[model samples]
Target: MALTETPLLFEFEVVSSEDLTFIPMCVRFNLDRFGLRISLAQWQLLPYEDRRLLARFPVDDDTEIEPNFDHALFEMLRTHANVEPEWFAPEEAPAWRNVSAVPGGVANQAGLADLRTPDIEDWAQLAPFQRYVLAKLARKPEANHDFVPAMREFGLAVPRNAAR
Candidate 1:
């Protein structure tokens, strides 16, 4: 029998004025109809220990249903945090020229020394956004372990830098 992998659902909260004010424009538009505004400084005043409690509130599944502002307010007293801005950017983006050319394709300057064809092909197959992310990760000195495994899983042949 095969075990199914469950998608991880992160329980997030908007628990402070800072979190409320800092929410991205997209989420802010959704929250505005309920007349909610979160301020960052207000959130800083709360004790850190109580912050996680905000996740106890379950998210509603209805796309059309508005968020419960009163509940949102209560949660804010202890729970909101901002998502990293970088997560929203395209993966293979910040469009720039490739650093070098291998037999079949080009590599970004960051990936020049350790060229791997299968890896290049695998990366090429991804959406430009995803390619951007892999390229960025590959170039990071601290990401060597994680990057190699990800490359192998994507069916890419290891580059010469594998031993490094």
Candidate 2:
């Protein structure tokens, strides 16, 4: 399938035509909401089709319906990789969900990258998925070269970068 056919996949994430070496933010976002974690090794073990399916899986947010993502992913892991899925407690209040303020990590990273920091109004305007993507990109454990690209993609004005 063409990469664009996978709506959750972003242009910045297209490291190669078909090499999904890194987990896309869309998969991460859904997994985070479901409170499950899959290792990179585990992800690589799945056939490309399954990886694409997981990336395409929808976030089940309807309170009135039973959520199936956790079970489906678990089965996929068990069937494909012969391993159990790891778990984490989902955040009671994820920073991205709080539109009242921009997370400090994101703001700090923007400043460090010499990009315009998003204010509350800007933050509020972002779709939840966009906010989630930003929160993940802003994390400091690694050098985040994608932050500028992501900001530009999300319609945020990033000035010329001194850090690039």
Residue-wise C-alpha lDDT for candidate 2, range 1-164, written one tens digit per residue: 22235637767777632466778887787788877898999988888877776776654433124355567778888998999878889888989889999998898888887776887888999988889889998878454888878888898855645332
Candidate 1 versus truth, CA RMSD in Å, comes to 12.1
Candidate 1: TM-score? 0.31
Write one digit per residue (lDDT tens) for candidate 1, span 27-111.
3322333344545455444444332222222223232453443355455554544421111222231331232222222243225
TM-score of each: 0.31, 0.85
RMSD (Å) per prediction? 12.1, 4.3
Error of 2 at 76 (Å): 1.5
Best by TM-score: 2
Which regions of candidate 1 deviate over 4 angstroms? 1-78, 81-122, 128-130, 139-143, 159-164
In angstroms, the error of model 1 at 52 is 14
Give the residue spans of candidate 2 off by over 4 A.
Answer: 1-7, 16-18, 59-66, 160-164
